[model samples]
Target: MSHNVLITGGSGYLGGDLLARMGAANLPPYRKLYASVRTAEQADGVRQYGAEPLFFNLKDESEIRTTVIDREITVVFYLIDAVQYEPPLFFIQALSEVKKATGRTVHFLHTTGAKLFSSHADAPTDRPLLDTDPQLYEIQKSQNPKLNVAREGVRTNCAVVEQAEKYGVRGYVFVPCIVYGKSKGFGEPVSTLRQIYMIVRAAKTLGRVYRVDSARPEWPVCHIADNTAAYIELLRKILTDENPSHGKNGYYLASSGSIAWDDLYDAIAAALVKRGVIADGSVTLASEKNVEDMGTALGVPKEMVPVQLGGKCTLSARRAREELGWKPAYPAEHILEAADGEVEWVLEHLRD
Candidate 1:
């Protein structure tokens, strides 16, 4: 019996990368991969990988049940955002439809972010968050308003996991931090790579560079290829019922390593210098006034100015390695190189 998999958000950056990897691996012989997209063009793009693309909105219950029910969708890879101060009830409803259709024995892979866990200056150094740690719940309660929505997501995910266990469905969630790689569609503009591109582009023309403050924090980062590999490994384990890591049904953070904002900025500057886009790495950190000026220059919102200047948020992926046997092939520098290549390609084709 061939395994059938349905992936939501198939036209996004991560989905595009996952589809590309599936094409490369050629695993799950006779795999019937279904991708849901918003537009006909996006559906066509997904079909290039030999996967069936279905046009359906995540919010439509009837559409979900109609498309997913009666289908032997043994595994599901959900990559929709339900947190980050966004409304994600539609995703929950869709998942409910899948649960209702599959009778809970289906393998559900939910994607989340590592930001669910919080950190503070007073925390003990040796008390890093563990899978069994219960402190995260408290920290989640005290998060900023923008992150309060994540608490609901976490609660919903926990409920789903519990329901899956109760109904004999296998569930797993992966929480990644700052995924970056070559993008294929209209990707979100606030990604780190996009910020880097804007800064590098500005530096090239303005003869000055922008750098974020180093003292803020370090962000955990992962390469798209590496992240995709982890997802594939998880999918294979679930579809085959192999209990790759002893049937652990909880959240796993996916990150290669952590890098300071200043370090990342320097790397992007170096890439721009290598490409001759900028004469030298003589860019200065954008002051508050410079940020406003640059926002106007770039035609982006001034409120997003601080995002480029923000520091990293740290996360650990040791659990992903120990449990799923996953490891990132490319480190931070290599990931930046991959992103720079993407920018260079875009510039070459888009340049008049």
Candidate 2:
């Protein structure tokens, strides 16, 4: 049976690009493509891409149920909140009902961050954690983070898998890392890559870029195109009934490789200095006052400054390549090369 798909967060950086590229992806046959939008303007914006606009409050369980069941949306790409489990649970249950009524295999893909699998969440950082590891679900469940966001994210990811399994709905945990590059979408043209953007914003406010971690920790990075391609490839696999791994076995990390946060900081700092956004390109460890000031700039607590700006996430991207035949066009270090352009783009879009 042909699948009817619904993709959420159409107005977001990743979702808008996904929707913009969906029409040209040349995927296996599907019945229809729908994009969720919050406003009439966004609804009109998505129509240009041939996606029917789906209007509903994502937080309202009844609305989610009605929207998914009535439309028979077999595939859901949830690009919205990663820390919230309620909406995904609702979507999974709704998809299960749709499966019961039509006997069609339904899929729910949740877009979570690589941070949830990193040091902040107490995930193992001594070795590379492959996305396809058999014990990843257990690893995720074992994570006990003091950081509120990491704790919530870990709980949400596990809950999504557990709920999907209980309801017989195929679920995937899609992890996006420090994705950078120009966003090729009608909405939210600037990338919401907090790690990179935080450096620029905090620098502008503090008059310099500060490193929260004394040790140069490495994290995964991906280009915007490569990140979107991973999403499309997974969808392609699902539409063709290839039955790609789901539930606990379906962790897909969309990173080309890993880069040191120090390297990223230096690259972006040089770019800022060239633009005269900061006084110097020298990167320094954040003093207590600097972290507090940075926190004030980021509107997050001082403790969360490091969590948001710097951390070690050794989550490797093997499943997408091995399972979906996905190949990233850009390398991980490409973000460093693109730092100047990325800074300009982000600066142009920074409202505050």
Best by lDDT: 2
Per-residue C-alpha lDDT of model 2 across residues 142-193, encoded as one tens digit per residue: 9999988889999999999999999999999999999888777888877555
TM-score of 2: 0.99
The per-prediction CA RMSD against the true structure, in angstroms, equals 4.7, 0.9
Each candidate's clash count: 5, 0
Model 1, position 78: C-alpha lDDT score:
79
Model 2 collision count: 0
Candidate 1 local lDDT, 210-311, one digit each (tens): 764535466677877788888877776665666643224356667777766666667667777777777777546677777777666556555555544443
